[model samples]
Target: MHRGRLFRPTVFIIISCILFLQGLSAAPPLQTGSFIRDAEIEATLHEYITPLFRVAKLDPKSLNLYVIVNPEINASASIRYSIFINTGLLLESKTPEQVIGVLAHETGHIAGGHISRTEGAMGKATLAAMAAMALGTAAAIASNSSDAAMASILGGMSMAQGIVFHYSRGQEGTADSSGVHYLDDLKWSSRGLLEFMQMLEKQEYLSPDQQDVYMRTHPFSRDRVDFLKQHLKNSPYANNRLPQDFYEKYDRMIAKLSAYLEPPGKTLLTYRATDQSVKARYARAIAFYRENNFPEASKQLDGLIHEFPRDPYFHEIKGQFMFEQGRLDDALTSYKQAIEIKPDAPLIHLAYAQTLIEKNQPKMDKEAIHELRNVLKDEEENSFAWRLLAIAYGRGGNLGMSSLALAEEALANDKPKIALTQSKRSQYHLKSGPDKLRAADIQSLAERLVKEKE
Candidate 1:
């Protein structure tokens, strides 16, 4: 079966190593761990956060949200309005409100300019400490040496403590107040924030090293919860309820994440026959798919499509299953339907293009090139799409375009030397036009990067 380089862990690891060696001259790309990308989940999160952003007087469109695959219950805000949320938090949250509450708190950090202020104070020292901690964490996982890991982390923290503006308790209080104000403005309850804080309260007894990353970064206090409680008691929207569909979407997001991340056997055991809800069935379908139970997987997916006929994501999942199972024609059909339902989703377009390239028919290759170019119009940074575009161009006998696409892919993947070579090669084949000018630009960038490395 032709694999279209989806979530290639090795590539990510290599990119991470390259970035580490290069040093943080610019903000290192967001390489925190495996990232989970799905159009539906992203849309849901956008819906959840847009109102909060508006309430906070921030532009919703400017914020970038990333769903990390880690199972830790943590969220962080970084430069450029980037917010990272862990899948574990979504799976563990009891209600949509709870997840929103966490997001609100993180948004509080963004609106209050906490991340930038902290970074300014710590400067390069903070980056160095983070690198040391990352190395220590990797060593701990590789060698199972908790003592060594703890020593490294504590050493890094200690070294940076003098310069780091470790958010004062007063800052935490301000964030809490800001979050509550956003919730109130949106006519949503602050109960979720209170409940989440109370849950973290149980971790107070644990040693600093034993605490989750959230508690480590956020620095919880009873007074923070009490302060929230006091405001919640007087807030006009204390008892408001989220929409019913909100719960359904939230449940499905959790189920999907659990199915994809957990062991197939474990997922199947957790979502049993008795629980016939849509989300449960979806999880079972994915678990069965992963286990290679093709018949059962198709059966569950068909049932979902039958029930929610217009849900584009269900169709997308079915397409993914068919593609993995080597049913190219059927997969193409399913992907087409999904795109028809949600034509604007770049991810769906990428998937469809990938399947088309894997099919490898000359006509399909041409179509895949068209689709990929369209995708690049909106998602220019997508290296996988660029890689597939290269494949498509090569298959269609467009050597110049193929070389240019390869250069773009290498650049996106941070292989400046490879990009430089490809860009130079493309210049030999490409005619004088916009494409050649673009190739020249890439060649210049690649040369600059190589010089920096030297």
Candidate 2:
């Protein structure tokens, strides 16, 4: 259950000993990436759990929910009330109703104050609460804003204090009841929940890492299913429930992403030379692209575009293929088509703008900057867009704005290409108008950061 990393959550002290024996780092980078395009799962959880919250006499409106793209099978209430689901669990779960069950259980953890009890009263502990300190909280903390809240969190500082786990038998029973009630309200079957619990209980017999991802953090047992079954048998709903759509979109996402995990040669072999199968053809296209078979990849994309016709993702892939071939104009056109179909998708706009910058066309400079600015609004931290925006501004003769954008890039990464661009632009504008000032600004910004880090 713990292989995905960071395993010492008070109840997981046993798992930690297993981790130590296995020679794995106790911590891994806290991930913030995930399947952001389709948020159906998170939104569904929010909708289904609302009734359960009311039944349990808790305010559902105040809690924030987030779907984080983590490979581990665990959910946690962050420092605040944000309920986070690892994308891995969503992709791996065999049934949609089972996911809803997981959501209900996590919500129970929240209402029961698992995170808050561990991390004393802070502000409105939102997933964004850490970042909110820089940008004021949308709502301040209610009762736990006092200093005593701080003491409680400090006491549970190590997260291994047996005192921190508040999920007693009573809370667990209540959570099961609320989960079944929520399922009944939605008219969806609750059998998936019990089945999932059974799987985790089986994992308890295996090695720690061999444990089902949920049990490491969720902690399961035989009693959980007994309680769930008791509720199921006692209810009139035992014979009544709605059919759930188990063909979850996340599964499709995983399938598409798996196109990357396959070996370049093996994936290519999976594709038929003919073009009937889009999925296989896509794997072939990816294989070729990774292998630097740009011309072949482009040809494959053309065939895919004709077959799928309306899939914007293929167009975006075509744009990438062209971009790598240095066919800037063609790449720009491909990306523009993708943007037309999915206008709100920032990656398409960013890709288009990046190609335009690479093209270094004077006429495209303004359009490139405009597109990048729009992308930044939705993705303030997209380092790639910042780099391209700097190029666009520099090409447009707006050296100051270019330098600011470059500064953002420098803040993101110290890629030599960006550094070289800044250096050259600074040289060209030395002691001149805004260019000189912009150059000086960039030099100061980059140098200051490097010095501070030193």
Candidate 3:
């Protein structure tokens, strides 16, 4: 299968090397992956929304956008002229109009100049107090990751409260009105935004975790919803409606994402479910899975697979689970089935490649080098692949080729992965020849070259 293991490890190796490899990264080190890929979504939003901002007298360039991956429902604009979005928010939003509305509101924060003024206000009045608190914050700097995050969050909240001037709820009100106006000017529908707000307002009654985070942070009150309704009443922009083509694209994107991210038995939640009851089940299944309810996850996966046996994605997820359980043969079979069903997905290739490397050492050593060579043919600057290929070469008894690759990795990233790949060469000066004689010869050569230059 496309994403399954290339081979099952012998029983002994499974107990030894497989366990050792998994142990190599027990505590997921700080995953500092690039946030650039999601920028495509931001760029698309910008292209469609910039004109609206222009008409509203906001500089599109000055507004810095940050897309963060936090599962929690939250958005903030205290320090940077930025919009930090959660992927969950994007997935859950019912429409593009609502997404644009949220952006408009954040833009309102920047245009309103909230965070800067607040900080400046504090600095002016209590330079001493702020300094003391800043120092106190240093106490939180003691090397615990959780403590540091809390300290930073507390620090930001503290400075925000005393020093920064927040645009009052009235300001939020004015922005809401202006934001809709901009949306209306752009001839985008306000229904989506209103619908989203109503959803949040209703959600306020539900458990905070069950509802979108917007309600909790945005400070929902009956007044805010009522006020929006009042403004939207007799409004020209209220008719901003989604086109049929837009729905088709939106549905397609949601389907692709659901197929990609959902585990087995997940009833696809693509802005709609087959039924409200089924949708609730889907959401609950996801919560259970996310909360580490593996039995529940398995149960849910089984249920969904039973319901939709024809769906290849479900089997793909089953393969993932089996792979995790060390059922290499089963995973391989499932992944192969998935590959037959969906051959074009790049992620499938990545998964298959990873599994292949994990299972068959001899095949992996040969295939990895071959793949890297082919990849280097197109893009020679791929230092990471080069490093891997170097290791493969070392495994193949090509020491010189391995060293050359190691040098490239070190030069490109300044951090060779580990000593396992002749890591000592990068670290210490080495020679099989007598070190004393080599040192003296190098010293003599240097002296002669230096004297000639002089």
Candidate 4:
């Protein structure tokens, strides 16, 4: 949905409140860190987790999977069936199976309702700690000994840990058992889980602070590794190997991530011409694009498309490159080819819509609006698409719809004040129908946020 940028790295944390419990004034904010919305990576991950979701009796479509641009080896499930995986974990994993195993563990947390239950427990402890800290600080001000005052503050903080640590450990154990079951049901080996834990076992030698973020969050133990090993011994698919295509997709995912995240020189050096593997060539092509060597980039991509004619991702990347180079007609052709190959890819549709808008022909504006609306039907949270929809509506002279789109875009981008303004503007132009009602609702929410700030 993002326009004019291949990789839009968000600068701020996205805070969303999902209210689960009844009669609560406020719920804890689910902080989804900066996300990368690469079409190929997202499509590959969706394929990988679909079977796990089915095994766990959970609906995959209801879950929002976010890839955090963190280098930490960690993943977590939040209360709203949201799974967050670090890019570092994906990059560091030696194989797709390792990443899948981690995903299984996180899915276990969601299926078991551990995130909500743990949040309830943690919430109580956090409130108690906050109260204690206030009381402790007051006592410290009244006390003469500074050392004794500091001890009092630390004691209050440790009390919160006491309330949550044991419960967290139990949840970890449950998730581990459930994850193994999910893997077993899907006829996949549990060895990957054990191997990941074995890596964690080495972290045991380090102090808690020195351990990897995964160890700190997931709380790995020798007993958990032993459990996985025992399960693998009895599993029918203990020695099963994943399909070669899965490995190729994994390689492509890693190559794309590295080419985008690392320096161009580093990518080129790592993926040398001597290594003519598809992934290596793909990475080198991206590196060339980053260095603005358009001819080399296009030549490499054209070769790839010739070899893998039906690969929608290659076409998507080609479209992106052409768009960046201001070759509008060529970009449109590539985007249409990608959409034809992968009709269900929302990101491709979004990219095509962006290209249509850029073309700026009167007829293309309507088509752009149609494409943007199609994407929003499946991806309502995409702020970039909403923004583009606003622009398209404006170009078509539908000021009411344009203002409404802007309002929604502002809300999605966490700008409540702008949303309020746009909503009011929309109400002035829109008829007294569902659209006006929706505008009123947005106005109310934005007003609430403004009042809270005041």
What is the per-residue lDDT of model 4 for residues 1-454, given as tens digits with 9 covering 90 to 100? 2222112112221222111110011111111233456778888898888899999999888777767556667777764466778778888888888988888888888898886435556556433323222211122224534344334433433343332222276788899899989988888877777788888889888998888677776777778888888888888999987767889999999998878766778999999989989999899888888787878888888999999999999999988787766687999999999999999988789888878887778799899999988887777656667777887888888899899988886666456799899999999999999889989988988887677547
Per-residue CA lDDT of model 1 for 1-454, tens digit only, reads 1112222222121111111111111111223343446777887898899999999999887776767655667877765576778777887788899999988988898899886444344345333323222222223323445455334333433342232224556677788889988998889999999988988899999998787677877778999989988988998899999878888889888888777777778889999978999999999998887777889988998999999889999999888777656687998999999999999888788888878877769999999989988988766656666777887888788888999998977776556799899999889899999988888988988888788658
Question: Judged by lDDT against the true structure, how good is candidate 4?
Answer: 0.72
lDDT for each candidate structure: 0.73, 0.54, 0.47, 0.72
TM-score of model 1 vs. true structure? 0.82
- By summed lDDT, which 10 consecutive residues of candidate 4 come out lowest? 18-27
Ranking, TM-score, top scorer first: 1, 4, 2, 3
TM-score each candidate: 0.82, 0.57, 0.42, 0.81
Worst 10 residues of 3 by lDDT: 12-21
Candidate 2 lowest-lDDT run of ten = 15-24
Compare the candidates by lDDT and give the number of the best one. 1
Where model 3 places Cα greater than 4 Å from the true spot, the runs are 1-36, 78-80, 116-168, 205-212, 242-249, 264-454
Deviation in angstroms for 120 in model 3? 13
Task: Give stretches of model 1 more than 4 Å off.
Answer: 1-32, 116-168
Write out the backbone clash pairs for model 1. none
Give lDDT tens digits, candidate 2, residues 374-408. 97775553445666676677677777567667655
Per residue, candidate 3 scores C-alpha lDDT tens digits across 40-156 of 234455554576568668766544444433344445454334455555566777777777677666666656665434443543423321211121111221332434523332332
